[model samples]
Target: MRLLSREIKLCSVLVFLFLFSLKVLAQPPAHDPSKIMRDGDRYWTFKTELGIGAISASNNDFSDWQSEPSVFGDTWPSWINTYVPDFAGHFWAPACIFLNGKYYLYYSCSTMGSHVSAIGLATSPSLNNPDWTDQGMVVYSDGNNTATVSNAIDPAIFKDDDGKAWMTYGSWFGGISIVELDTLTGKTVGEKTTLVGGNHQDIEASFLLKHDDYYYLFVNRGLCCRGVESTYYIQVGRASSVTGPYDGWRTFLQTNGRYIGPGHIGYNEGRLTYHVYDRDDDGTAKMMNTTLDWSDGWPVAVEVTQDPPGELLPDGTYRIQSFDSTKIVGVANNSPYEGANVEILDFSDDNINGTSWVINNVNLHQYQIAPKNYINLGLDVYNCVGDDDANIGLWSYWGGQCQKWIFVDMGNKNYQIRSALSNKPIQVNGTFESGTNIVQMSNNSNDTTQLFTLVLLELEDTTYNQYPQVVSYSSQQSGNPASNIIDGNNSDGYRWSAENFPQYVVIDYGDTLSISGTKIWTYQNRAYQYTVEFDTDIDFSDPYIVDRRTNTSAGQPITDNFEPVAARYARLTVTGAYDYTGPWVSITEFEIIEEEIVGADELTLNDNTKIYPNPVVDVLNIQLPAELSSGADLAIYNMMGQLVFRKTGLKGNIELMNLSNLKKGIYSLIITNNKTFVTKRFVKY
Candidate 1:
């Protein structure tokens, strides 16, 4: 029955165009992964073999990874051969913990499937510094009496809430076992006791996590190291005490479609990291990450899809209600065009058109908000300004900083919607009223005026380009050349830093292209003031100030956007750090964003609309169908669906619109009336 059920589940997954495969990305191969560790701004996870391979990611994003030099780097500690005479350089299932201002890394040493194994320890002052001091064998098994002893492999360390430390180590030989460890010396302190799988069940790689009142034990079951054929899955059990007769073990994670052999669970900050056989990639072992949803007492991994374009929110229809519960966000007079004032209004069951909004998730926790009345227009900060009390309004959705909002969850289904431009939440001008204006202001967490609740009404899917190519880059600092900013590594040793104030870095795309925004991965999480400028030519004769930020408290990878502009060069000038008083400026990585281009096939429109002079410079003529001529409205939006031009109450089939001041780019012309709606694509040169 179990085998039949597994086959049926696999068949169902194949019918959905392999939606489960969407969660997998091109990641470096990793096996027996260590618990993810954080060093300053980077995340590190060690793997088995290849000298204890160390892999890292920047800004806490595990989707993409970069490999650092291995810890041993071909030099093995001489003491390993003393235990297992034929011991190779390969170490397995490393567990790392930071304690007392130092890091202790424990690794398993032995040949494959051998009971004559030993666990060794290495200490380092810092992860960035490769000065690992080898501490000889912590524990070992002779295996001379094979049937009576447990194999010393896959060591996992757990520190209880009482500050007492314990080590759990073993494999399939005689079952999993646990022993107390001295936190000061990283060594065993008491005798070992067998826990589970007494010489019968195929179990290994055990890990323990304490949450609330339970100590949950996680272990791998079934065969491993067989590539695509491996059946390794994660099983978990829980107990009330640190050491106990645990409850019945149940499957926690198993193979899903192309993600086969999910094993070696490592957790950090409510997120789980493991390795899986990627059937799609020739069964290669790859690292996988997911957030843990503990709402149901037990932890369940939540599948995270690929990041949306920039910081757009997930595609959905929602009701945005203020914390007062009586008020919701609405457009003034139900207007559906640019510059329409957004305000808080009394909730009404029949006011769906005024209260409901369409939100598109881009990346991280940020989203682009559009009203249901006109999904083409987005919620905007007036004039793209980040000043306090900046009025919030409705504008064309152009993927600009003014339209993106970060939803900060404040518990109880309440959130603080902060503007990506100003890093402030929309608050009532003074007090809540029937038509109180909403303006961006500094956050006061306790203020009810700034909190909102989003009730999801519908769901949709959208994709975006996360990172565009950077052909070349230059910076003002020579000591740490700006070239490091585009080197594809965000580790501490590969950052661009300058001790001088007003330092700058320039990224050149090698060709003039439509760019919407850029994000900076700063050296550290300190507040920095900076200015961004864009230009088509290398010379600054006609530069456009895209964004100028000051007094910001945003964390690493600070993101900002501007209206889509045709430029080949972008410059970031660091004015100062930490209230503009610090002298040094550092940056690890700089990403340039390309404007999002939603294809015409993605839109539903009448097929009769026509436009001429696609690459128009001064004037654009539109030949609309007779049905849409009179009493109709026309709106011109950029590639990102941001409204650039609009007119109402049209009266004729032939409408001539002048776009002389518009920049060169692709745009969509949308014409609508009470009954007919159509959209046509054009270009402005």
Candidate 2:
């Protein structure tokens, strides 16, 4: 009866969605460009633009600088070979965390069978290292014995505030499941619990995060992996515990203007958000889509804003309440041909507003012509081509005829197209050259005797059928010799060594601190020579070498203990190599635990203090009982260390400052009046 019910439900879904049973094959489509997002200084996004299909990882390897943005758009560095060999596959759904000085990247891979789906683990001391050690399969589900769905994929790992490690995974199964893990070893420790289950179709690519004592579970639903037909969308539920009978299941797509199929919720800038799995300009299925917002209890489609407590628009969009555009200069088109109409065709919507002249209608006759002539205009013409038959045609009246035939100012200035035949209005001899003379001429105003016809044309794609490329490095170099090779490998003189080094931890002297302990981990049978260097500058030269240590031992973990020193920056230099080269050593983790030391010192100064009302709407008022000292600095910094305001001391009893420019977040106020230093924290709401 259960089998019959399953068959009946499948038939009903097919009928409702009007899906055909044509033995469809799920293959990576061409022109899959995923949206890219910025995480701090590094850009993290799925690599679909290169048309390489679903990329598993971006190969960020220090030794292999070329490994970044992995050849096939996979961010996973090639270094995993140093640890796991069965790591080869279309591995995707990467969740990375920096814990205990090591980067743990958890991802999943699958072949044709649902039971074959498995989650894998890889670790690297650095994100940009080619040396990733595959920790092997963390979990696997075969359809025969496991749950209804054999696909055990989409793994997300997180450590709670209490120092407990947890992983949530599963897809097309009953629902999402949460499992506890042994932190020391990436192995499951507790029994898997069905956190949430329902009749709704849930393909678990669950992202579990805690906010305000609530654990949020984000899951993907409906059909996914279909290029244009993928009904990928996101839903959220919250529970007080990691493994919960989560309530408040809300579908973000139910909102207006809300796009379909948002999946893979990732924390961006410390906020919960999901990726939009939608069609690209060419209608290709893209795994890396735009970001969605989850500020409110329910998920809303919103833009990423640096400001906290931003507003959610009526259309479910986010507005950066604190963004100031008054200081920005508006883009103006000064060229005479700015308003001219240019016919564009055959190009995908992605390239429509770009600078490239990718036109439709591959045939020469179908090319688009500029709406107006390039008579008088000073503009930059980009990828447009000229007509072979005409010497002079319509041109804008700009300084040079070429300038008249300029492309419009598109964002990023990459897809602009200009007429190819525009020439200088004034001839060399103060006379325009008659027909067909513009051909073979350079940008010479003195040769104005040559009249030119500006014509629009398109170019063909050159990188068709080309597989992603990677650089092969020679193993003879040592001590990060590859670091010098910033560009592509060319001259043997061009290649440099790239190595991973440990970063030092430091504490300020102003704070009374007592060092409790220090821990370090060295991976593989690697010997390392460590030197403690100190200097104000981070340069290698002129460093004060404080201490050094060398380990000739060959084995697995190594531990060292030492006393702590108060310094601004600690420098750790490794020498002896391990694994692949000479004196190679990779430090997996280094930590320094400290405790606060209390002291008793008495100093007092009498001064006037004044603050405004408890609640401030637009402006905040500050008053002083006495005139402030000259040259004193008043500054306001946000929680993220961004300076929002700075001013000098003024001789006024009361000061009115505009708080409208500030975002709804916490800020620190530093006022240096006379010789006294004062610091206070305030909330801007």
RMSD to the true structure for each prediction, in A, is: 23.2, 29.0
Candidate 2 shows a clash count of: 66
Residue-level lDDT tens digits of model 2 in 1-685: 0110011101000100111112211112212122222323443333212212222222211111111343234344454343334444345565666566676666655432233456667666654333567787777765454334335566777789999899887765345667888776677897888775321123456777776778878776544443232345566778888888787665544101112244566664433334332221222232222234457555554542211111111111111110111110011121224432222122243322221222211011111222212212222233222222222222322112132232222222211222322221211122122111122223332232222222233222211111011111112133223222222233334333323332122211111123334444454434554554432221211334433344555443344444543222233444334344543334444333443332211112113545454234568776544434345566775432335788885556667778887765445565555334444445465
Candidate 1 residue-wise lDDT, 296-354, digit = tens? 56777776442111222345688888788578889888888889999988767666787
lDDT for model 1: 0.68
Estimate candidate 1's RMSD in Å: 23.2
List the candidates' TM-scores in order.
0.42, 0.35
Query: What clash pairs does model 1 have?
Result: 312-361, 312-362, 313-360, 313-361, 313-362, 313-367, 314-361, 396-642, 396-643, 397-642
lDDT of 1 at 383: 81
